[model samples]
Target: MKRLSDHTDVQLTELFTLGDIDAFEEIYNRYWLKLYSAAYKRIKERATAQEIVQDFFTSFWINREQVKIQTSLQGYLFTSIKYLVLNYKRAQAVRNSYAEILLMVNNSFDNSTEENYNYKELLERVETEVNQLPPKCRNVFELSRKQYKTNKEIAQLMGISEKTVENHLTKALRYLRVNLNSLLLLTFLFLRR
Candidate 1:
């Protein structure tokens, strides 16, 4: 794994903007394993983590021209992947909670209003973040995260190249990282400083 450096994401984005593919490549090779590890640690699914990294990389390259990262590229990626894993965990928790609630409402006739309400509120907060995504990013994210659609599906649906779909997802996730929670978001955003 390439060692993490103090270099800011803004620098990398500027390099990419100037058509420096090698700079982008260094950023990619440097963080691919680290980011993959972050995702694996959270999701504990090898295939899913690998897919997440692969998707992020593809998206990064696709949007090289327009990609703008404000912090350490590594931190931005880790935070984004963390959000993805949290969203997945949140969805699973809701499903399990709902099942339990149904069983209780059916068997013991007691509704756990507090837990259910809290979970739903958190879920809504996350969903609101997703909804805030730009149109193409939102579409790509929904297709990949919700529909489990492949890049081909997203490309065909959006009538863009698979490469374009990849960029859309990458850029979208970057935006999410900045918006979801401002603590890490702020840390990353100010990474240039």
Candidate 2:
């Protein structure tokens, strides 16, 4: 009898779908390293890449019976990793944004006296800068931040392409970051005197 590891991918996939633990193990052994390497290359973090690969295998086994691989198992696995990487990056972007805002707030508090740390005035300054953005860019930025709409939703509401919406957002953020940093620096200098 051939070893489970010696079985062709088609045979292994068939056995896996039928809840054969050995077949599943064989598949894992065959693909885990390749999948990890691919993920690591894209994610550039060892721990995250390992976790992504582990999650893929865990889900594969859990949903074994329902998995419908129309193409080769290898193709399906690679496609799954691609989407997993995309999701990880999207989630990371959101986390990074929150972290940046938190750091900015913390630093501002550290550098200013109670009298100088006026949150309402800071918010008003931000609103003033946001209002100075070009008309369409300001609308896009407001829809995204104030209304909490997604890029896709903003694009639909404004009748613009998603890429255009993204560009407007990027431009707005760059402008705000530059302007706000300058304002903060000036405030710090004034407070020191």
The global C-alpha lDDT for each of the candidates, from Candidate 1 onward, is 0.67, 0.82
Model 1 Cα displacement at 93 (Å)?
5.8
RMSD of every prediction? 15.1, 8.4
Candidate 2: regions farther than 4 A off: 109-111, 115-193
Worst 10 residues of 1 by lDDT: 101-110
Query: What lDDT tens digits, residue by residue, belong to model 2 across residues 36-95?
Result: 999999999999899889978998999998999999999999999988788667645643
lDDT of 1 by residue, 85-175 (tens): 6655654453455345335334432256854554455457657888988877898878876887766677888898765776777676666
Worst 10 residues of 2 by lDDT: 108-117
